[model samples]
Target: MKQIKIGVFGCNRGGDYFRSLLANNADIVAVCDKDDFWLNKAKKRLGDGVAYYASFDEFIEHPMDAVLLANYFNEHAPFAIRCLEKGIHVLSECTAAGTMAECVQLVRAAEKSKAKYMLCENYPFMKFNREIKRICDSGTLGKILYAEGEYNHPVASSDVAFMRKYKPYAEHWRNYLPRTYYITHSMAPIMYATGANPIRVTALPVFAPFDDSMAISGSHCGDRAAIITTLNDDDSVFKVSGCAGFGAHGNSYRVCGTEGQIENLRGMGTQVMLRYNKWSKPAEMESNNLYDPKWNHKDEALIEKEGHGGGDFLVIQEFLNCILEDKKPPFDVYFATRMSAVAILAHRSLLELGMPYDIPDFRKEEDRVKWESDFLTPFYGPNGEAPTLRCSSHADFTPPEGPMKAYLEAIKTRE
Candidate 1:
């Protein structure tokens, strides 16, 4: 077997990808991290055969066929673009990029690069989601008219304190991202199901009035936000996401078509419902529960012990296959641009008070070039003006009381 040499950036979240890579017996040539704490840990886990580097510049020079970008959610694009420019394939852990400009640059870079780029959105590869996609693609549900996806994550106060403790930098992307920015986990699956991209979006964010978190963390952004999106190729309106401190524990999705519908069960069960017109010529209606099913052995050899319901396994396998076969990944640069643009436009819609914002087709050169100069991000430059709009009320930040403050006092990392 030809061992495809791979390097990974960001070893913390990179663990899952490493495990998946190991399953395929890929040659783990290198790993990189900004922090010595993480880099040292990765070296211990990956062994002496795999090289480690604190600087990405050094790691990029190391021999590798592909790079798994499991870095900061806001900072994948620049690194991925570099890898592609160097003729190294890249599989990005999503949001794809931070700003519209990065999205535009990413698309343009991949278009010119010989190496392939893929957005590793694991949600669509989940057991139920794949089943839904198969059913929809089979035309069993007719035209998918409406769909809903929600990822409401409640970050505990302690977790906030811990993140602040380790990464005390003021501009750390995780600390202050608006609830609306991380909508890809929910939105990507819906896009995958219908093979459609959201054309425009309207966003509304609900500010959390929790006094403890507000007094402790000073998060001006909301605890929950919702975005309604219209698909371009299909007449489907997708209710995409509500995120951050929404006091919710799980994620779920549903799509209703002209003929039928499919939805996951509420609560802590893996039950799902599938309703459709039976394929038989009798024109009969059928309803079936999708649970306790047989295993899908499509990528049996490579994706056996994968994460995200074998999605992590499948996505990496596809990336490898695309590299070997010299084909574009299913979720290539265009798809990444579209998904990232949804959040970008959604946040813009919130700035305009739920007004609709148009999502440009980045596949077009003109549409992309116009956004090339737009470097809007959650973090600000030395100049007082940050991005186009500051999501937080306080431009200057103060560490919150209790644990976060104690961490600041005890161990100061950055900023």
Candidate 2:
């Protein structure tokens, strides 16, 4: 067995994968983060065997075959590009690019690199979601037509602790994140299950700012969620949320086809509900059947011990398998960039009051030419470049001064 050497960037989220990487027989060669707290945490877990660095410039110079990018939500593309430039494999977390130009740059970098790039999107590997894909692939669902996914996570207004930890500073990316930005959790599973690529996207915002009296929030966007709709290459339509904060906290998905429909039961753990017309129900199956899914994976024990319904473990396993086998990952650079395009354009649609935007196919030179110079972004740059665009549907919306002050105070107390 060839042990793949891997380094991780951003220990805060990247450290979560240390055990999984070790379980898959990958050597933890190096780890890097700007924060001493996170770097020290990684040191504690990986022991003194791994080299640690506080500067990414020096970290990337370390000898490693691949790098797992679990950095900030909006800053993966530039780092991934640098890795690809060095012929280092990349397993990126979540949305691949923060802007259209970065999307173009990422595609170009991957095309020119010998090493592969994969989006570490784990939602598709969830037990029930995998079952949904199985049923879809089995032809029991007939021709897939429409699907829906919702990732609702609503924190309590009084959870100042969360604000202190995640949104520690006013200029943090999370503080300025649009409702449609954190989209992969709700978008990837349906795309994987149905084999659909989004061609067009539009969205509407669910605007409901938190009460300043109860919550200490520094988030610039007041929208609770973005209801995004996509028209796919397969003629199927997908409706999903972008990290919603509405109703109850749950991750739900549904796939409806010509003959039948299936959905994972929210608040019911791994159980799924499958339904079909009497004439369309398959043999030995009821018109309406509900059951919990079985893992049936070789790494079931190790997977069960991990997070995200065991998806975290499977994602690492798949990435390593791809590397060792000299195969491209299913969630390749193209797939990742496409998802980022949908997210970026969906937010544009929300700002435009639901004006649809065509998703460009970066594989086409014409499409790449169209967006190569489009660098508009809603995030502050590392050098403090101001955002070129607004993040919220309400362009003038900002957290009240009282809440902002309280939020800063809470973070200071934590320090």
Candidate 3:
């Protein structure tokens, strides 16, 4: 098979999956990023003959079979649409689009273009998660009824300030985002574990205190958010939480079914527990906790090394295989768009005081038309995409300027 030439955007995050691409049926042709520091570093570390561009406009014009969209979080949709127009396949990072309207446009673009698109959501590829998928798919955990996923990464005031100030571009999406929008990490795994489509979405925001540093950093967006989603297949429900102000440091998940259930190690190191239900009152369920290498037989390196338990590498490899073999990726554009679209409606539900919103089935043509013109958002981009900083969690709160100044001073000292 011939090697597919690939160009990666956002060198900072781009570097994480480089080895994986290089190891697969692909060639690293170029990398693009405005951050000269990381850009120069990646160019040097990867050696000579590899083109590097500071401008995305010029980078897209480079000859390549595919492009990796690791740019700022909310900018992938527009960039991917342009790439598809250019007839280049796309492998995007997280949360497919910033708004529902963009989601519609993105789906339509991929539908028309010959090039394919895959959202590189890595959490679902984690060793435990993959095992959960296998067990559920095998019907060992028969008829999944409920699931839970959580991602809590609390940061100090200084790091949060620096992130708000000097990170990426001036109007970085993370700086002004609805808490529910960053739901991909916590929610994608459950969706992948079971092939369930979210039919309805409702959310409750975890409000931050007035004195919280995040509130000071122009993020009145809740410190965290809880989303309750009802699935289309069996009407199953999934509870997902993300960005909790202060809580556990990593990701965790749990799946419950009729025959058995499995849960992440969580605070218990690297072990996971598998339990089976019994009707006897004295012995209702059996539990086992240990690491079984057999669970990740498909890719042992992923469980032994690399980032996110080696999931970082596995997801990239899957994308490349799809491109090389002319196969559809595991997480295709439609499924990925649903992930982002559900988050958009979940935020809407929060704004309406936890009221439920029906998640439009984008698979149906009529459903896409209903939301074709619905792309408005509270948080904005350089293009006036949104106009508010606060979602429903906090009222009358504005992102403070004091932290911004402090963040600027800290970066200036470093320079």
Candidate 4:
């Protein structure tokens, strides 16, 4: 097998995949990052053999077969387009594009380029999620009618260390991230399992800002979660949350159909609960069965050691397989853009007090034209452009002055 030469951008997050990439026989030829701390950290893992650059302009010029874009959350599309134009395969991290305009541009770039583009959505590859997909594919679940996914992640407001590290500057993307902007983790698994494409979306915010007495870290967003509901092409409904903050930290999913339903038991560690009507149960099967899922993959040993419930390893493996086989990935450009559309539009729905928005299908020229000039965003741009949209549901809401000052002071103290 020819070793695939790959470059990683954004060392902090990208470094997490070093072991998995090596285990999959990929050569890490180059790495790029703006932060010297993270760059030095990457050096410790990759040693002196790998090329390092602080500028992507120079890094992208390196000879490589593909690039894993783990850059900023809202900045993958432009870089991915450049990789495609250079005929290099792109494995982009979550939230493929920041704006509708970029989504259109990415779709066009992928259509014209010879290289393939894949969204690295790992949650769909998690053990229980894979099992859910298997059951859904087997037709034992009957006609799917509804599904739900929650990626609740709550952090302590007192964790100034985390704030100093992740949301370093006031203008950082994380500070202005809307409740519905990080939807892939909560949205992708259900979509993948049931093969449902969301056509319409509506959302409402759970506006629970951190207490004024605590350090609010200069974050513009005050919403703890966004309850987003989508109407799929299959006429099914799905309810999901995007990086929610109002619950105990855990991911949970449930899929219900005409005759049966299946869900991963929360806090159960890979256990799944499958239930069916007595009359609709599979032959000799019980009406309800709860059990732990099996990895069942040849790389089970290696996968068990990887992150995100063994999803990180499987996602990379799938991306490499697609490149080797000269095939498009399941989460190809279309799928990625669709998810981004849901995320962007869902936030707009929240802003409008739950007004539904139609998700554009980039494959169609008409749909592409509709969003071609839609560049509205809730985040600050690379050049420090002011946000054109509000990050929180309450337009007048801002981080309290005292908390913001304390947050900044805490960061300075660490420095």
Candidate 5:
């Protein structure tokens, strides 16, 4: 296949995956970031010949087949829409749209443009989760009754590097968002492995003191919330805690089917224990070496060495395969919306003091019009476009300024 020329936005996080693509399937023609530090880093790491841009407008003008958006979390939707409108393919990161309104618009944009839109949700590609998906689909677990997924990262206290780097941006609404807003990381795997559609979700925010403290510290917003979701033919419960103030680090999930249960083992990276009522208490178990080989069997050993537990490389590899084969990606726009839409609805439930909410189907074209004009994110103009940061909000909120404060200022100036 001819090499696909691409522009990668958000240099820091974009570096690894962009480099992986360069090493495997594509050419990194251009790179962009608001921060000079990342731009310089990308230059050093990806080589000097690649063009780099500091501004989004300038980056979009570069000739490229696709745009890999590794920009801000809340900003992905508008940027993806713009790229699609310009006839460029887009691969966006997690919680694809910050709000339900943007969710509808994003899907419509993809449908109209006929350009490939893929959600880079790496957790589903993790070896343990991939194995579970294989087994569950193989009919070994029987009908899935319930499952739980979590990305309960204590980001505030765990790592000093990110805390210091993002101190300024962390002070804003994008940083101190509602508790339920982060549900995708902790919830996507179950949805991916089980193929169950969540019909209704009742989300109750945990108003414990830990969350209140984080809010006061200008770190996180409300406390963590528990989502009681009823799937199409099954039921499940998912809870996630992502405060700088509390909880453990990393992502994990558990699946309980009518005949068995599977869980990611604690402490050991990527190990899991499968149990069943039909067999012994510890039905089966595996760790480390045995783990990676399960999923790596499909690709070369070199590709296996590339990503987060083999996931990062797989996501990139799949994106390239879909392009070459003229096929829709497994994690296409419809499923991507399914994985992220609950977070938006869950946030609504928190605002209503944990009222149950039904997630709307964006796949049905009829539902698109109801929310096209609604902009749910704290930022964004009524027309669903990015706005300029005003003088009062122009100051960069790196590490020390905190994310909550930076977030509010962002809404005031740019929203």
Candidate 6:
């Protein structure tokens, strides 16, 4: 196999992506971040040979074959376009574009440059989701009727460390991102499994008292948003309840089809429930025991040992394999963009107060024009007047005290 040279941007959360790249034994030529502290960390972790750059302009000019974008959630599109323009392959993180215009620009850039681009939608690589895709593809699920996939992460209360480290930037635009703004994690799997793209969306903001709890906890964002999306073939709903201050963290999915339905079991087990209309009764299943049964597989064991539900490893592995073999990553750029575009358009729907919005089919050339000249400016600016990203707030805005304060303080001390 030819050696692959790669550079990574956004070294903080992109740390996992970097670590996974190292584990797969690919050559990491450079790593860059806006934060000088993280850029140094990448240098230290990757050793003296790994080049570190604080300027994106200089970083893109580096002699590398591919760029792995772990940058800000909304900023990936512009950077990805720059890399593609330079003939560098791209693997960008979710929320592909901040606005519709960037989406079309990105697609056009990919086509014009003829470079490989993969959208990093790792949720589909989770063992359960992969198995669900397999089962669905087998035609065992029959014609899909209706389904629901949910990502309910209690990051507010649980991720104290995350809140503290990035708190300075948290008050930036990302903190106040719309509730539906981060919908890719939950919706990608359903789209990946069914091989369908969301055609249109009618979004509803789940504004309740929980929003106040997060604001009180110093979160600058909204509580939740639900999207009722119409897919090309199957009608489905995706809900992202990210009231970070409420409850324990859990992620689950349920897919109901014409012949059967599969649901992930609650609690510690990664179980699924399959009910076939053709059969007399329903049955339950576990994803790990079946498809990616052993987390210790040489290629995947390290992933299981390291990150979110063991998906980190698999996703990077696929990225490496594709680059080395000159093939396409399973979750290619177009696929990743499609999944991410849902969140972008859904947020548009929410901002419009549940207005219906059309989702462009990038696979078709004619559809690209609707958004090409458009740009959705983000809420935050260099001048620091962050736009007010609102959702209905019934949550109480009280500064946390007692154990929670002490806990947050302790984490801050460590940072």
- Candidates' RMSD to native: 3.6, 1.0, 3.1, 1.1, 6.2, 4.3
lDDT of 3 at 280: 17
Tens-digit per-residue lDDT, 265-356, candidate 3 = 78765456777755411243355535543543565654356677767878887888898789998788898998888778887777766888
TM-score per prediction, in order, is: 0.88, 0.98, 0.90, 0.98, 0.82, 0.85
- Candidate 1: deviation at residue 148, Å? 1.1
Residues 110-167, candidate 6, lDDT per residue (tens digit)? 8888678887767777777766777778776777666566666655544566665655
Cα distance off (Å), candidate 5, residue 157: 3.7
Candidate 6's TM-score reads 0.85
Residue 389 in candidate 5 has what lDDT?
26
User: Candidate 4, overall lDDT?
Assistant: 0.93
Predicted candidate 1 versus true structure: per-residue lDDT over 1-415, tens digit per residue = 6778999998877866887887767778999988777787787788888888888999999989999998877889989999999999998998888889999889888889988899987877776777778777978677789998887676555454555443555455555576677877788877888887878888876654344633434343434455555556676788877354564577788988887888776564556787665553125444654563334665665554677667788777778878877787888888888878888778777766688877889978788877889887765443444545666433343344554454344335432
Pairs in steric clash, model 1? none
Candidate 4 Cα outliers beyond 4 Å, as residue runs? 413-415
Query: Judged by TM-score relative to the true structure, which candidate is superior, 1 or 2?
Result: 2
- Model 6 spans with C-alpha error above 4 angstroms: 156-160, 209-216, 233-247, 278-298, 382-414
Better of 3 and 6 by TM-score: 3
Model 1 segments more than 4 A misplaced: 160-168, 213-220, 242-244, 277-285, 288-290, 298-305, 380-388, 392-415
Q: All candidates' lDDT scores? A: 0.74, 0.92, 0.76, 0.93, 0.66, 0.67
Model 4 lDDT tens row, 1-415: 9899999999877999999999999999999999898899999989988999999999999999999999999999999999999999999999899999999999999999999999999999999999999999999989999999999988888888788778777788998999899999999999999999999999999998875685556778889999999999999999999889986889999999999999999888999999999999999779999999898899999999999999999999999999999877999999999999999999999999999999999999999999999999898888999999999999889887877887777766433
Better of 1 and 3 by TM-score: 3
Error of 5 at 124 (Å): 0.9
5 or 6, greater by TM-score: 6
By descending lDDT, how would the candidates be arranged? 4, 2, 3, 1, 6, 5
lDDT of 3 at 395: 70
